[model samples]
Target chain A: DAGVTQSPTHLIKTRGQQVTLRCSPKSGHDTVSWYQQALGQGPQFIFQYYEEEERQRGNFPDRFSGHQFPNYSSELNVNALLLGDSALYLCASSLEAGLTSTDTQYFGPGTRLTVL
Target chain B: AQSVAQPEDQVNVAEGNPLTVKCTYSVSGNPYLFWYVQYPNRGLQFLLKYITGDNLVKGSYGFEAEFNKSQTSFHLKKPSALVSDSALYFCAVRPHGGYSNYQLIWGAGTKLIIKP
Candidate 1:
C-alpha cells in the first residue's frame, strides 16, 4: 500500500535554467496532478495528467509543463526559471474524475525548488 | 471562476480547548469543498471533503468540517486540540466544468497554533 512518492527532496537552479521533478502516484491511483507552493502560501494547481494526456491545467504560463507515464508516474518540468519560481513542487494523485468515485487526492512529500 | 477563502491568517487555541478554522468558497454550481493540513516543510494532507450528502464530514486526526451551503462556508472543527494539531490548514474548491474542472482552487491557508 504505497502512498504517493516524489524524488529529489530538494534542488537548486539558476535563472533561465530548466528543472525536472518526478512523482510516483499512490497505488491504485491513476490520475496525477502538480502544484506549486510559494513561501507562506497555499499550493496552486499546475496541471493534471490522465491516460498519458493532460486533462486540465491552471493559469500557469507556457514555461511549466508535465508528463505522465503509462504506469501513472509523472514529471513536472519548468523552463526558464526565475527567482519567483523558487517554491515547493507538490505531487498529488487521485482517481479518474467523474461522479462514480470519490475525488479525494493524496499527496507526496514534495520537492523544494530553489531558483538561484 | 472558482475560488476559496480562509479569512483567518492564524488561529491560536489552548491545548484541550475546542478549535475552529473558517473557510468560504465562490463557485458557480454545487460546490465541492475540501480541507487539507500541512506540516512544516511537508506536503498537504487530505482532511476531508464535501461532495454531497451529509454536511458534517469527519476525517483524519479527529478533524471534522461542516458544509453550510446557504453561507457558502466549510469550517473545520475539533472537540479538543492537541499540540500536534498545530499546522497550516487550507481550504479548496473543485469546479464543475471547463478544462480546469479537475483542478483545485486553493485558499491562502490558515496557521493553527495549539499552545500546550
Candidate 2:
C-alpha cells in the first residue's frame, strides 16, 4: 500500500506571499496533520484535520490553516509568509479509529519551503 | 516549555556498536509516545510507538523503544548500529486528554552518526 505522499518537494517564495502545500495520507488512514520543522529542531505541530474539519490545532498563528478532503487527502496553506516560515513542512496521517489514544501517525516525505 | 526533551543534540558510535537515543516527556494524562527518523530532506518516518501493553515496542527498520512510565521516558535503541542508520531522530508524545488530545508534542531531535 502507498504511504503518505506530499507534493511540490521544494518551493521558494518571498515574504508576504502565500503558499499551499498538499498531502495524501497512506492507504486506509482517515486523519491528517501538519508539522513544521525548522533547521536543527524537531517538528512543531501545525494542525490536524479529521472528517473534513479541523479537530485540533497547535500554537500557530491565524495565517496557517488546513483542509481535509473526503478522500482523506489534505492541504496546508500559509498566508503572508515570513522569512522565519522557511522550513520543512511534513504531513502525517493516522487512523482516527475508536480512540484517539491508540492512533499512530505515519509521515510523508515533506515539502521544503524557502521564504526569501 | 517543550513537552518532550531530547537532551543530546547528536550521538556518534561505531557501526557495530549498540545505539541509544534518550527521550523524556511530560503530559497531563496517559502518554502516547513515538519515535521517528529523518534522512536528509526526507519526511520523518515512524519508528515505534508505546500506547499500552509491552513497554518495549518494536518498529520498522529494526528499531525498538522502551517506555518507562515511572521515569516518564521513552528511549529508542538498536542492538547494533549501521552506517545507513545515521540520521536525525525525534521523539514525540501525546497525552490521553486535553483540549487537543491527539496532537503530538515533539522534542528538538537528536542526530545519530555511525562511523564505519
Candidate 3:
C-alpha cells in the first residue's frame, strides 16, 4: 500500500543545465501528472501521461518534457533551466477509469528544484 | 476558460475556533472540485472532493466542504481549528463529464494560521 514516491528530495542546477526528476506512482494507479509549485503559490499543471503517452499539457514551454514508463513510473525532464524554473516539482498519480470518471489524484513528496 | 479562485490570501484563527477557507470555480458544466493541504516543504495532500451525491463532503483532518451548485462554491470547513492545522490550502477544479481532460485548475492557495 505504498503511496506515490519521488526521488531526489532536492536538486540544484544552474542556467543552461538540464535535470530529470523521477516518480513512482501509487500502487494500483496508472496515470501520472506533473505540477510546479512556486514559493507561496499554488501548483501549476505541467502535463499528464496516460497509456505511456502524454495526453494533455498545460501552458508550459517545450523545455519541459516527461516520460511514463510501462510500469506507471514517470520522469520529468527540464532542459535549459532558468531561475524561474526553480520551484517544487510535484508528481501525482491517478487511475484513469474513463473519460468521465472523477478519480482523485494522490501526490508524492515533491522534489525541490533550485536553479542557481 | 475554466478556473478556480481562492480569494483570501491568508486566514488566522485561535485554536478551538471554527474556520473556513473559500473557493469558487468557473466551468461550463458541473465541476469536480477538490481541496488539498500542503505543509511547509511538503507536497500537496488530498483533503476532500465534490463529485456528486451529498452537498456536505467530509475529508481528512476533520475537514469538510459544502458544495453549493448555485453559487459554484466549495468552501472547506473545520469545526475546531488546531495549531497543527496551520498550512497552505489549495483548491482545484476539473470540468466534469464529456471530456477526457484530467487537468486540474488550481487556485492561488490560502495560508491558514491557527494560533494556540
- DockQ scores of the candidates: 0.67, 0.75, 0.82
Instruction: Output the number of the TM-score-best candidate.
Output: 3
Count clashing pairs, candidate 1: 0
Measured by lDDT, the strongest candidate is 3
Ranking by TM-score: 3, 1, 2
Measured against the true structure, the TM-scores of the candidates, in listed sequence, are 0.96, 0.95, 0.97
User: Model 1 residue A95 lDDT?
Assistant: 87
Candidate 2 structure quality by residue, lDDT tens digits, A1-116: 99999999999999999999999999999999999999988888899898999988888999999888989899999999999999999999999863454878999999999999
- After superposition, which runs of candidate 1 have C-alpha atoms over 4 Å from their true positions? A97-101, B97-100
Among incorrect, acceptable, medium and high, the docking class of model 2 is medium
Expressed as tens digits, the lDDT of each residue in B1-116 for candidate 1 is: 56788999999999999999999988887867899999998888999999899999999999999999899999999999999999999998887643337878899999999999
Q: Rank the candidates by DockQ, best first.
A: 3, 2, 1
Error of 2 at A86 (Å): 0.6
- Tell me the tens digit of each residue's lDDT in model 3 across B1-116: 88889999999999999999999989878888999999988888999999899999999999999999999999999999999999999999987677667888899999999998
Query: What TM value does chain B of candidate 1 have?
Result: 0.95
Give candidate 3 regions above 4 Å deviation: none
Cα lDDT listed for each candidate: 0.91, 0.90, 0.93
